[model samples]
Target: MSYQDRRSPDPLRRRRRTTPRQRALLELLKRDNHFRSAQQWHAELRTTVGVGLTSVYRILHQFAEQHVVETQRAEDGELLYRLRDTAEHYHNLLCRICGRAERFTLDALEHHTEHVARQYRYADVNHHLDLYGTCPDCAGVAQQE
Candidate 1:
């Protein structure tokens, strides 16, 4: 009930501003165009920001749903995320260790899928195709080891 108590900020509480955190997470993503698990992103963010792990997962989920980021499954089935390179539908050749990606499109595959869908009378058919390998830089590093 003291007059000065209400005017002072709460020292024990950590402020969590939504927009800044979201933008900070985004800035982190922009630093590299490489896919990583949410846990990985959170661990990296911890060194630079005060974002919580739950917030990291939630923000990444929101970005995925909005198509602000692209996601793919790693070899062990963990979901990986990266900033989307384009608005169009496409696939990528991903590097398993380094997360490097090269976006690609296959017209023959698309046509074959469409034909198969029509043959089976399936509507709204879609597909996901990704190739995983080691990029040259990672391979060279491995060779040196």
Candidate 2:
């Protein structure tokens, strides 16, 4: 099927236009909090949805462009993807090994950002916080080896 044909025909639909495969992928990501690679997503999807790897990669890139998901680079330089949180702003501590993430909010950081922006007379400022490191579980496992 062609890309244009995958879009919703209904003009009244309020949500962003997405293909059936894209919707399925979003649902899967909604249930999983950890970042996962396109290969992993495609592997899981194949068991039920039978989507092609190219389709998975295309849909993931589209989702990322639409701000429906976030992307990060792993230590090995592979790209990882996960659904974005609904909160206005937050930080994520990502595990380098497992792609697990811990979400956090800090008032001081927000205040500091605002203070700095105001000092510099900046307007329409935005930020994305993603701190990457080994989570405690991964750290423990590494220490054991």
Candidate 3:
């Protein structure tokens, strides 16, 4: 039998199946909160899910648009992504050693941002902030040695 005929003849059946690439991507992101580049994620996914680099990039972009993932810019300007902990605007306090993250918001910063935007007549202002330190567990481990 030909490839098409050999497979499920029902097109709807195939369409109903979840996109494995997307599912795999979400699972990976959910496992960690560290901001990482698409290539960093793709490297891990490639080993387990065989997802392509381009596909990973595309999926991440879609997640960003949907607000399913938070996006940040790396020091070099490459966009990084992490699974968002909140539906509202937030920032992160990141554990440098373990990559754990705690979500937070600064009302003063938010107000200032808005005030500056209004002063300049800019619309739709947005911001990002991340704080990093060695987490308690990691620090304790170091002390024991």
Root-mean-square deviation of each candidate, in angstroms?
A: 13.8, 8.0, 11.6
**What's the TM-score of each model vs. the native?**
0.81, 0.68, 0.67
Local accuracy by lDDT, each model: 0.76, 0.73, 0.70
For TM-score, candidate 1 versus 3, the one ahead is 1
Please give the TM-score that candidate 3 achieves against the real structure: 0.67
Local error of candidate 1 at 88, Å? 1.1
Clashing pairs in 1: none
Please give the ranking of all candidate structures by lDDT, highest first, separated by commas. Answer: 1, 2, 3
Q: For candidate 3, lDDT tens digit of each residue in 43-77?
A: 88888997789999998888765556767655455
TM-score of 2: 0.68
lDDT by residue for model 2 (77-138), tens: 68888886542456677898778977777788778978989999998766666678988787
The better-scoring model by TM-score among 2 and 3 is 2
CA error at residue 114 for candidate 1, angstroms = 0.5
- In candidate 3, stretches whose alpha carbon ends up further than 4 angstroms from where it belongs are 1-17, 95-99, 130-145
Give candidate 3's whole-model lDDT: 0.70
The weakest ten consecutive residues by lDDT in model 2 span 1-10
Model 2 ranges off by over 4 Å? 1-13, 16-18, 73-78, 140-145
Best by lDDT: 1
